[model samples]
Target: MRAENTQPVDRTMDIETLMRALLRDVLGLSQDRVDAFDLDTPLFGALPELDSMAVAGLLTEMEDRFAILIEDDDIDGETFETFGTLLAFAEAKAGN
Candidate 1:
């Protein structure tokens, strides 16, 4: 078998980092705070920062950053309820 170290991501950009950038762009939060936020954090209800306008801005930012189109119907609360869920969805969208 080949060595596990042989991979492209090491030389190339990481999707998680890109997702974080998108998050920063959308959420208007610092990178440190974004890193601190975990996978299961209550987004809309608990997080006061995630207002309806902010959510819409985030959706637009994510679509632009990831080079993917998002329909209005795809804007589900569960998708942005946490960092991990959003990362996974972004990964799936970017075909990573």
Candidate 2:
């Protein structure tokens, strides 16, 4: 397995800010709701809109926005169980 990257991003880049942006842009959630979410909150369980189609949209968004490649077999429900888990997965893919 490859080693995990731990370098920090630019000071202008905030993890929470990036996470909220991802939630809103990729998940089509309003800023209001996105802002109120806890780290452990289950995004799909909390929002009914995140079904199979939403997963496709999310994967597309990740590739476009983060330049993170997600293989077909790389993800399953467990990886998406919570907001923090999903964000961690993205952070790992981003090598950060």
Best by TM-score: 2
lDDT per residue as tens, model 1, 1-96? 776965665321476777667667666778897677666755676667778888788778877877888887766767877777777777777776
TM for every model, in the order presented, reads 0.73, 0.77
Which sections of candidate 2 miss by over 4 Å? 1-15
Number of the predicted model whose lDDT against the real structure is largest? 2
Assess the local accuracy of residue 42 in candidate 1 as a C-alpha lDDT between 0 and 100: 55
Instruction: Mark the 10 consecutive residues where model 1 has the least summed lDDT.
Output: 5-14
User: For candidate 2, what is the total of clashing residue pairs?
Assistant: 0
Candidate 2 lDDT for residue 31? 94
